[model samples]
Target: MAAPGCFMEHIAFLEASDDPAATTVWKEHITDDESEGRTA
Candidate 1:
């Protein structure tokens, strides 16, 4: 795959839905956007 142009474009995918490790990352992301006054 081609490299992403921006730093935020970099992504590491976790396929398991119930995985505990990815939970906090996703929560942090959502909270960050909410704190910044943005939407999904």
Candidate 2:
């Protein structure tokens, strides 16, 4: 199981992220940004 604090951190990481290239790179493993696509 994951910790509550870790879950919140993950949410923040996803919310604050703005780099498409980086998002795409990270998406290679996690699909959170799949629908959004590149944000420029």
Candidate 3:
């Protein structure tokens, strides 16, 4: 019913997060590599 559909939408939103923490970690790694004169 409508409740199940709403629940699925909520689950989808949670799963869709691009994970900012993970992105920040990746950017930091790239920055470190750049400082070391390496490519990302």
TM-scores for all predictions: 0.23, 0.18, 0.22
Per TM-score, the best of the predicted structures is: 1
Q: Using TM-score as the measure, what is the rank order of every candidate, best first?
A: 1, 3, 2
Each model's total of backbone clashes: 0, 0, 0
Off by over 4 Å in 1: 1-8, 18-40
| Comparison by TM-score, 1 against 2, better one | 1
State which candidate, 1 or 3, has the greater TM-score: 1
Extract clashing residue pairs from model 2: none
Q: Which ten residues in a row have the lowest lDDT in candidate 1?
A: 1-10
Give the alpha carbon lDDT tens digit for every residue of 1-40 in model 1: 3223433335676566786665646523434455455767
Ranking by lDDT: 1, 2, 3
Against the correct fold, how does model 3 do in TM-score?
0.22
lDDT of 3 by residue, 1-40 (tens): 2332242222212344587565443223334445446774
State the lDDT at 31 in candidate 2. 39
Q: Between candidates 1 and 2, name the one with more favorable lDDT.
A: 1
Per-residue CA lDDT of candidate 2, range 1-40, in tens? 3433343224323455676566644433433343336434
